[model samples]
Target: MTEAQRQIFVFMIYALIMVNFSGSSHGGAVSSEEEADRITSLPGQPKVYFQQFSGYVTVNKAVGRALFYWLTESAHSPLSKPLVVWLNGGPGCSSVAYGASEEIGPFRINKTASGLYLNKFSWNTEANLLFLETPAGVGFSYSNRSSDLFDTGDRRTAKESLEFLIQWLDRFPRYKGREVYLTGESYAGHYVPQLANEIMAYNANSKHRIALKGIMVGNAVTDNYYDNLGTVTYWWSHAMISDKTYRQLINTCDFKRQKESDECESLYSYAMDQEFGNIDQYNIYAPPCNNSDGSTFTRRNMRLPHRSHRIFRQISGYDPCTEKYAETYYNRPDVQKALHANKTRIPYKWTACSEVLNRNWNDTDVSILPIYRKMIAGGLRVWVFSGDVDSVVPVTATRYSLAQLKLTTKIPWYPWYVKKQVGGWTEVYEGLTFATVRGAGHEVPLFKPRAALMLFKSFLRGQPLPKS
Candidate 1:
């Protein structure tokens, strides 16, 4: 691969890492309490929760990590209910961004300062819904020391997040025994599984275990090459990429030989290379607004200083809800703080909120490969779901990645209809059932909440889905 192509692939590597993307080991244990305290405190930082709209913040006394999350009690029925934790992509995206504000949270935001609005179809009503800003770096979670952003990568994040959950559930012990499900879209595909794996492993290994029922990933980024190739075909099928261009690119383009000829440019430039914005080439989901200011990666503060999900553009706009949750989040007094990304790194430009991660390449894949097979061998159910429209981690890529399974097709592939249309489909093979969300893009919850929720509900019950 050329230097540029290598960087493009690197982007994919990090996305995989970020998304439940796993990586090499990080030294364990949160810094000592005294060390956490001695980091020159930003004390009295209150967590914000939604309803009773709670997106409240809390510190894990055990780990000295700060976590921000939203919770809902709208479920009139809480009898042995399943507690679902939803995640947004970005490896660093806020679940609160799409999960709470747009997808299944209890409330939605209005852009024009109309205040919080109740979602007519919030998912929490069926089950207790929760959204969290994990890993101490993403979303409202922060540390007094700027260097706190440095400990990123898959392994550390996975452990820290599990620690966070254990700590959080410890704090809210009432729901510890509740059937728990992990759900997310885009990059979260990796996050949900990896996190689920950790929870499952911990429960299995620990003396005092926990209950983690199942996991669900939507339009996930579980694999890179297949997802990318899937993108080429999906775009071509929809005329986004013409047949001649597709043929020319496919015939010459090669992942193994990215350093070859002009075909390298086709995959590098054509595959990515947006005309504007400095989003990581591998991350196809929308990025935080590009600041008009001439700031370099670190200079550009990702804080909305306004709305996180700005509805400034209306191309086939699905919803306009910037105002409702903007203050609930981006407007949080803490988020408005200045960018402390890199003091000595590039100082003129901007990077996304999770930009600090851009500095290091976290290319470590998960170590749970054997565990997955082990789970199936033990009669455990492992279901992986996909969204068809995601370009970053396309459905095609997921299919290609899982082909490695070579498992038997226990339940044959079939169309899964929603709203009387091709709202994607499903397939059950071996011990895994892979499904697709039609018409939904990367953030399946925001684009297709009902279908996504239905998928989770079915998985939780370990039962076949209802005919639409």
Candidate 2:
């Protein structure tokens, strides 16, 4: 052959080799048509303008452990929007049940407790939302290895979650290299930071890295000692417990050590007995759910007799039994098939929170402040929000925990407005931001959807909370 012909042939061979290499780099070519994971229609879902996908990402192939995720694309310009992964912290909670169904997802459970309705203020209006059921044995995600089920903890959870994200991106290659945000509430204070740290480490070592840009955690549990102390203070300040009980609690309980003397336990119990009398500890201002007889209490007249009897009431059109509704909706055979869930037909039923897993959770970090400081220093946007009214992981706890960081104020604390009304208070620091959702409980979005959306949109835009 002539020199010109040989050169042309070599160019064609090189192009072919590059194509193969590109495909192999992404673990083989992934089809854009993810029909297998698409939701044709949920059982009673309202007509929607956006697409939804739900399925499992196998994190541990040998153990058959997988983390389940539900993704809702933005209502408009999904391709241009950033992706936010939302997690709910119980250390064992299902983000699908809490974060998706009740808080920020595109849909909410219907009042009848068996169907879904569109959440007018869903976060998907602003960005693509991804909700994950992590660490196996939570909600629809499961582990074939029983030991894996019982042996999960903070570090393992972060590792598995990171692995899931990498594989998930591979499955939905369109989202590869997209700007990603990690957001969660409660225990996720621990999960989000730990997972973000892991992602940062992975990005440093790998050729393909997740474009994690920011993290936001709301009503989070950041430190054990501060959280506990704040709880007692909140209870007393709210007049839920007696002053004597409060003083006894402070003096007797060694929150830092996680050890309580026998007398401390007695004082704690007494304080709780006064504080929880027929009240939902999660939301102090909300009314309690009534029994079938329309009575709010049991016949025995005991103070806080049965915890199960403490039903959640509707607060600002939010239903506490939304978890129960989601449980019913997801367990339907048709719903599972439509979402591509329960592929193995895991023998166990799905629940909002796994009692076993929560009980068995190991390695509870006393504080995640160090992780936060590291991430902030690394230039990742970090925002912490709190629902001022939530008794569980209240705003006071978050304030105390953040005080540990000793961050200087970049912007003086101010009230953030929504629709010409004060929605919440916000404070901007050198490396972190703190905000509160007025009148919101532990689940901020559930109680204050409009305010929550405002906060989320601000976070995504890297703008301060609305000042008007």
Candidate 3:
């Protein structure tokens, strides 16, 4: 038999043996089926005061598609805190890896991936955090129908996510009417607003409405034209690319068109490959992650920077190889057993982002500004933030995008503080708020956890960032 056929046969045999454990793992009695998802404790985990749960919610029964979620309740008052749903956007990134493990989630995996340490500035202190691995094929989420993995788009993903939320509410009914916020970054610039639109539409006719209060997206991709233009400009301004390359990018690339010309693609390649050095484009100042052999790998070689959900972790200083730690931890058989993940014995390793979905992402709205307008008009609190150092989706791109809104300014731009030091800058518009984290990168919380936490707190309170 051919090696390919032999591997298929082995996978089939393993799948049959794993059938008994295929469904969501749950055994001991509890208040609800969600008890099945309650993570009593993770292996090598430190003692924690908050409750945690990780499990799958079947969003599509016909396709047998399920989305995985990890909920970390607030450390203080779990019952009274708001629920914040976080998604990391690669079109196919695992929020469990980025949002839950590296950024806002309470624990950080160690270098060996054998133990966990607490993130002192975890967002769970401000809200009950739920990190979702969405669109069926990312992370632990999967579909019995293989085609579902190849055919996912914004519309279907938003619909399935809405369905997941509704069913998840059924599993944990206590959070039915709780205050909620939709949050994400990067390609989730599409996921967050689109899902918010779906929820708003659902609430229009249904008696049971999700109490969604606000939404906050950081370093988000809102408009293709502005994002592309701003990215090229950022590259030039940051001295990453030559003046000649910048001029070529502006003259050759048609930012308005969804598909760039071959000439444009070539120029982009030249700028990135030839001019840009072995530095992290996500954070220009941060050192690039080195391979296990201690050789350097540029962000482009590892993964596309802005387009993918690759992220970094910081405790005292940033660890460039932190994403590797998540890959190591989640791929472990015992760790998967602990988190109740990978029950079907899927024939693949866990990656931070899925190249398949990234390549096959069916429909992307050229601009999400219309949805932003609608949300603003509807009086939902909206904040668009950026990390100043993130060249991938820089502060300038966000500013250019928001300029199109042209809302009257409520608060003029000014520095905001976290302990007498400048945390970032903020400017509140009539309906929307725009903020910038001082030295943060694409993932704000991972770079500036305390400032990100302060931003989250202010967002929750519907107040402006502190000017003191």
Candidate 4:
């Protein structure tokens, strides 16, 4: 590349770094009841109020440029708060879907119901919460150029996310010197660390000062090599796979062996054949909704209760209340308007995260891992949590990803207690911690709101989950 071109590239990257951070906007979009206005701010989304103060941060507008909208909220205390930029993992999922709606956010959507519910515990109470619909293609955030998809990879994604932070800080100048943390789960395992590392690097190079602290990932897709293996192991351990099937996969499904087949066309075919036939990963939980495909396949997304993925069938939920809510809400136009989800339109159809990206695409794993390691080594508090029950990117898969890290255990394994009772499991290696939500499935916040909130709160404080 020419020198001018390289400089341009760097300049654009620098702009990207600072683009998504904008300050407060007109708050009227989310209306409220006359009395509720005293409490809630956002309406469609259950305005679960955090104790902290709130505001909006904007990026470049979507009208022309690739950089679209950015949203930010901070704890309104004079003392700076640790900032966590939260991303949800769907290769195409919305961060607001899980991080805001279900997990640590102050608000939650009612169980299969259209309306919002209050979460007594919200992660934002402890730290400033930042949620994003990154990569433009995901949520309200959009890119005018389709070619932007070419930027898909660990490195670029992280770089832009970091830039978003710098820009966010620039707008909310008050947070300029605050300790910043990056946290997310699922595919974000790759996103959070990569971005956190870039911020660390940027702070070092820039004449201007930037304070970056730590990172946390819950059920992130960290390591590719062992992730698949760990997933299979989880299925086998949970009795989802039979012994013969496990042994067969164990004998053939090897990452090293698969890597050697780089030039061989049949290599991936053989590995996949060995993989897909084993117990369905989604077998961990029943299909959450239909697969959006045919019945022949277990839903590729989170499993629901009764539906098959193939037919896109709606499962007869076992929870009578949830079932009634689902039935009633599905028929209600106002409720459908509230969820405002992806894929399905006003008539909200309950579905798992569908195949939203190109099948054969790019991965910047090599570049991304170094950044993750840097964040970890730099004493950035990192946390990875997951519901053991999620079949898609199962908790076992997360465990397998972490096992590849080889980080020494800083905190020994123990049941994370919640409400004076053991809620689930937690462990720490060096500064990175991992936790499991016992009965919770794919969406931890929706299924295990309290535990998820506790997990988020602990991350904000850079402490372990409080023992119940």
Model 4 off-target regions past 4 Å? Answer: 1-80, 110-115, 256-283, 290-360, 366-369
Tell me the whole-model lDDT of each prediction, alpha carbons only.
0.55, 0.80, 0.84, 0.54
The alpha-carbon deviation from the true structure for residue 447 of candidate 1, after best TM-score superposition, in angstroms, is: 2.0
Q: What are the per-residue Cα lDDT tens digits for candidate 4 across 1-468?
A: 996666456546543433433232412222322112122233345322232222222333442222222233432332345766678765555565556655666565576465666556666556677777665455444445555444455555566666666665654554666777777766776677777767777878897667767776765665555665676577577765567676766665554331423323243334335544433232235443332363443333331111111212222222212333433443455533333322123122332232333221245463235565677778776677887776556787677666766889878999988888777898978857888888776556656667777777777667887765
lDDT tens digits, residues 236-348, model 2? 88888888888888886787764457777677666556556766566787765554688652211111100101223232225545655777787888878878899998888
| Model 3: CA > 4 A from native | 1-31, 298-317
Please state every model's RMSD to the true fold in angstroms: 13.8, 9.3, 10.4, 12.1
Error of 4 at 221 (Å): 0.9
Better of 2 and 4 by lDDT: 2
Expressed as tens digits, the lDDT of each residue in 44-63 for candidate 3 is 89977677898899998887
lDDT of 4: 0.54
Instruction: Give lDDT tens digits, candidate 1, residues 1-468.
Output: 696566456545544543341222222222232122221211122221212223223344544456566566434444346778877655555676667767777555565433456665677667777776665666666554455576565666667668767765654545556777787776566677778778877887887566676676666655444554665666566544556667866676664331336644644355333331344212233333332484322222221111111111211115423423343445433333321122222222221236564233154343234545665674556777765655545677678767766789977777776667666778788777888877665556666777877776677778655556
Which should have the higher TM-score, number 2 or number 4? 2
TM-score of 3: 0.90
**TM of each candidate vs. truth:** 0.70, 0.88, 0.90, 0.69
Off by over 4 Å in 1: 1-64, 243-266, 271-317, 320-329, 332-353, 358-361, 366-371, 378-380, 419-422
lDDT of 3 at 125: 84
Task: Please state the error at residue 468 of candidate 3 in Å.
Answer: 1.5
**Candidate 4 clash figure, as a count:** 23
